[model samples]
Target: MFAADAASRALGIRLLASGPGSATAAVVVTETMLNGQGSTHGGHVFLLADTAFAVACNAAFSPTVAAAASITFLAPTGLGDELVAEAVERVRQGRSGICDVTVRCGDRVVAEFRGNSREVHPRAQRPE
Candidate 1:
């Protein structure tokens, strides 16, 4: 997944670290990510946080996918800003999981995200 995350790669996002139930990702805002308002796009910010949440949830679980997610933007960032997203697993039970991700620029939080994941059986992907 990391080798071929085309969307994240296109946005210059890098997975800095990941482990069971935790992950961190980073991205440097560029001109292409700016919106017409001249600030970073909210979608890009959500993507970064969502990526981190995905990694953390899938770290120990096999082929987990997000069932739902929501984000609240706290601040806006400009081009050249360095953003970091960190995800932590809040709960995982019986194929259901919850994760929280925080997006920040330095010490200031830029956004908060929560993701709900449901684990899929590998067998489900096989054609009958």
Candidate 2:
């Protein structure tokens, strides 16, 4: 799934590792990712966290999509800063799951994200 994610790839997000219910990814903040205040855009940070959450949710499942997600920007990052996002599954029951992602720049926390996921059944993939 990571290999096929063009949006993540386009943003230079690298999948560092993944397991049954966890994933780690990283990206370098670039000039294009900056906001007018000379800091990395919040969307970029969310994207990185979301990518890790996506990988973790799909790691041991057939397929899943985020039912809902929210993020809190704890700190700002700037150009050339390397950010890493680690996502861990908090709970999973039936077709619903919850995951949390922590985005960091080295030892400093940059953001926190929580994602609610729902498995996409094969039947749902069929064209109506």
Candidate 3:
């Protein structure tokens, strides 16, 4: 999707999955994205996971909206480190869904996130 691409380019993200529900996406860590200690910023990880969640939820149902999200940082990542974010749909309730996403570098788990999204009715589908 163009939104995904634009978000990626503007935020310096990379697509690892070809489609929405795929599993993972590669994220390149740059110095600009790192903190003072040379580790990736928490916001970067959150954005990566959030983007993946958006794609996953939207692919299943269009116009999906994020209801809630929680992220946990387990480890640190640095510049030049290629991170992989994997998102899995955990549950679906009518027009809403929950997803679990994990970010890793090789065998190290860097972060994890849980997100919820809701599908909004299209203009044509709205009740008149």
Candidate 4:
């Protein structure tokens, strides 16, 4: 069981108090995450969302891996504008699960992400 705070800390994400997923974790956009235009880079946003997904999935299953993932950039995020990413479990089947994630800043959604993950036994915990 991964507490929300621990999950956020593990992923280097911060929890925001407002937004679509306000009560959830959001990645703080920094200068190092900017692109040539000084806007948040798409890869950086994706990584943030991906990290959230990793924590969400693995928190329950111990070990999980992303099987498929995609993100659509809707708007640009500037430096210092906290980029919030949220992951909600959509469906689960056996050892596989699907999550719908969204990244936003204030009222503007920066990106939408969907991730498919597979739960696997940890290498050290593998059965003989």
Candidate 5:
């Protein structure tokens, strides 16, 4: 899944590691990623977290997509900051699951993301 993620790749997102129900990704803040105040834009942070969430949810080979997601920005980051996002599956029941992603620059937490995922492929659905 991460291998085919064009959007994430375009923003210089690199998949660091992944395993069953978990993933880690990183991106460097670039000049183009900054906002008016010279801080990294929230969208970029969200994308980093979203990418990690996508990888974690899709680790099982079943196509999954985010049904809903939200993020909270705790700190500001700027150009040259290497942001790392770690995603972990919090819950999975049937075809629905929840994942949490934490974006950090070094030891400082920059953002927290929560994603609600739903398996889109029929093969992932439980038989009645």
Candidate 6:
């Protein structure tokens, strides 16, 4: 799934790790990812987290998509900060799942993201 993520790939999001129910990704803050205030845009931060969430949710082998997602910005970051997002499945029941992601630059927490997922194709059973 990461290999086919065109939007995230176009924005320079790279997979750091992926497993059954977890994933990590990194993105370097570039000039293009900044806002008018010289800080990295919130959208970009959420994108980083979302990318990791996508990888984690799909790691089950069954295709899934975000049913809902929300992000909270904890700190500001600027160009050259390599933001890393780590996602882990929080809970899974029936056809729904929850995942939490933490975005960090060095040791500072930059943002937090939570994604709710639903399987898009049920025929593909999620691998345990």
TM-score of each: 0.94, 0.95, 0.86, 0.78, 0.94, 0.93
Q: Give the runs in model 2 whose Cα sits over 4 Å from its true position.
A: 124-128
- The lDDT of each candidate is 0.93, 0.97, 0.80, 0.73, 0.96, 0.94
Best by TM-score: 2
Clashes of each: 0, 0, 0, 0, 0, 0
Q: Residues 9-128, candidate 5: write the lDDT tens digits.
A: 999999999998999999999999999999999999999999999999999847899999999999999999999999999999988999999999999999999999998865555779
RMSD of each: 1.8, 2.0, 3.0, 4.9, 4.0, 4.4
Residue-wise C-alpha lDDT for candidate 6, range 1-128, written one tens digit per residue: 99999999999999999998899999999999999999999999999999999999999757889999999999999999999999999998887999999999999998999999997766756779
Candidates 2 and 5 compared by TM-score, better number:
2
Off by over 4 Å in 1: 124-128
Backbone clashes counted, model 5: 0
lDDT tens digits, residues 1-128, model 4?
23544644654566433222112467777777789988988887887787667666765555678999999999988878888777877777898988878887998888999999898876775567
Once fitted onto the true fold, the runs of candidate 3 whose alpha carbons sit more than 4 angstroms away are 2-5, 18-23, 124-128
User: Native-vs-model 1 lDDT?
Assistant: 0.93
Supply candidate 6's per-residue lDDT for 76. 99
lDDT digits (tens) for residues 1-128 of candidate 1: 56667888887899999999999999999998999999999999999998999889888878899999999999999999999999999999999999999999999999999999999888755566
How well is each residue in 1-128 modelled by candidate 2, as lDDT tens digits? 99999999999999999999899999999999999999999999999999999999999997899999999999999999999999999999999999999999999998999999999876655566
The ten-residue window of minimal lDDT in model 3 covers 15-24
lDDT for 103 (candidate 2): 99
Which window of 10 residues has the lowest lDDT sum in candidate 1? 119-128
lDDT of 2 at 52: 99
The Cα error of candidate 1 at residue 44, in Å, is 0.2
Candidate 3 local distance difference test against the native: 0.80
* Model 5 bad stretches (over 4 Å): 122-128
lDDT tens readout by residue for model 3, 1-128: 53556866687676667455445677789878998888999998898888778777776567777899999999998989988888888888788888999899899999999998888887685566
Stretches off by above 4 angstroms in model 6 are 122-128
